[model samples]
Target: MDAAPLAARVTRIATLVAGLPALPPDDGSRYSPRRLTVSWLLEAESVHTEIAHARDLGAFLDWCNRERLDPLTARPTDLAQFKVWRGAGTGGTPAAASTVARALASISSWYTHLVANTDGGVTRNPVAAVKRPPVNRHTSTTAGLTLDEVDALLAAADAQAGARAAAAGRTPTGQARYLAALRDRALLRLLADLGLRISEALDRDLGDLSNNAGHRTLRFVGKGGVHRERPLTPHSLQALDEYLAARAAAAGTTADRLSGPIFATTGAGGDGRLAEPNIFMTLRRLARIAGIASADRLSPHSLRHAFATGAREAGIALEDVQDAMGHADPRTTRRYDRDRHNLDRDPAFVLGARRASRRSGNQR
Candidate 1:
């Protein structure tokens, strides 16, 4: 019997009422409960601004129902008005072309659902009548570290930080230094040796890295949900062993556990309970330390690209590279080598050379 709880109940009812679709022929039957729920989920999935856009769309449909405007009979002009209204005002800024396309797709899905279930057989979907905005193809080339640059980065990483840490155990000032070196070296070797996406690398759990005949082999999932296996190269295997040893020493925990993130902070305390490193933060740190090009977007992806390109330049086959990178589509793998391969035979280079002397040019 409290006013506050009563007010809360009324507010919830009001919100649900605001989200309902327009009424059908028979007043009570038009806005079926099932239709409304499905429409809500459909619209929610389609638009990025789900709640507001769904409310607006529901309001518009409700208006059409009040006016007895049959969606089946609605013309292109009505849809155009809706598009203009969407771009101009009501709730939020103009939707992206992709967003609009998705909204239309949601509408189509609802209509199709109705067609299959309801007695009011749908003749044609209204969304198909609307034309979508044209999208421009992005023609700019993708930039990645070249083979020489990749070598330089790995060498720089090894010489600048990796090597110094490896020598940490020789003296008393180097204990923590040794652990840090092993971790970083393991990270770099994983990136260079396996051509792993940063996300893929960081997603690894302790169980993902397994030992087979003293050789470390990694099993992980890749893009588009494909499972792949990559044998750790000798260099990477050594780094991993060192890193695991260092990790076990710091945590006083078993490295061969079936749980916990594969890579984590060495020491415990203050949220360092053996968790994964954020990919973005890790890449930013690497860029700062490596002193690579500041103009290019050099993230963990750059490391993957460098690995693929380096292998290709070293005469590794496209199919092998595709399997190694866990790319479902070989065409995606081909893009990595397109620019580098073209540079080898670029016409601009061949034709732009200065001709010293045309000594035999018809004896002048």
Candidate 2:
């Protein structure tokens, strides 16, 4: 095979992977092992997952190119070296254990697909013989907001919306700003209230909101393409209603007539769906206005962390919280709870409380 630029190879691989299903059925004669392997491996994955896998694999392919090694025929020793290089940071800063683990997982999945689909063309997965970094499942490194911080963030968003609303009728610019502020307020409320993944929240359409058993609920396609519904809290519903009303007013229509993205750009020609970066920037700006100490590091996920931690601290059962967060594994939910290992909530404290109560009863 001819040596190709890394970017070109990645682009070609992505195109091939996306087009695989449309190709007519044929024997192994048509495609290269690499193309067939990537296509089959990522066929069932969502677009987001496919892109991530491609990126991770692309990094490894780039490394192989630099090392004068063929990725398809790479040995265990080659993978071991690649792992060390990746962990040590292709840049100056070392990658996190979880990141390295994910990269290795992507590579391993690729080789596994090749071995399974190619008969005896590939003997084994080289990544199988390589040791992977241990990922800590009990905790995450993403910063979490406290209940007070969550309140402050909401207040900040509300204040901005209020200010913008006052000027909305004056000019077109004012109306646009007011609309955007309303959207931001509602988006923040939903994130804090529901702990939705940013992607899940952004993917919402106005039509997704419906009455389920007389309760207002949001239907979203969550991780793994699972359809899930979460009942909206009164506060979340109110925020959403206000935003929708404002959006409809801006469009010279009623709230009932509005449809499409729940959070959309204010631009006239832009797609209605709000991008993830927009939410990220919005959160950081609100965090700064809220005087949060971690304002610089604040992200939309911080509100999700706040939801999980606040719910757990308020004595919500782990299983219930896990269900609300749409986590398949309780451990993943636990990772979002900042106080999962808090000493103050230890079983010893519960035991001590019971002992004290028993002593009082005995004296009585």
List runs of model 1 lying over 4 Å from the truth: 1-142, 159-181, 212-215, 266-278, 338-364
Number of the top candidate by lDDT? 2
TM-score of each: 0.54, 0.83
lDDT tens digits by residue: candidate 2, 1-364: 1234335545756565544332223454645564675565446334455656867877887787688787767899999999899999856899999889999998898888878777777778999999889988887889889899999999999999998888999998888889899889998999999999888888677788888998999998888878999999999888889988878877888989876678888889322778787888888898999999998898888889999999999999999999999899998998899987899989999999999999999999
Candidate 1 per-residue lDDT over residues 225-311, each given as its tens digit: 567677889888777777777667555665664245566654533113222334445454555566667424666667777787788
Deviation in Å, model 2, residue 344 alpha carbon: 3.1
The lDDT of each candidate is 0.60, 0.82
Clashing pairs in 2: none
Worst 10 residues of 2 by lDDT: 19-28
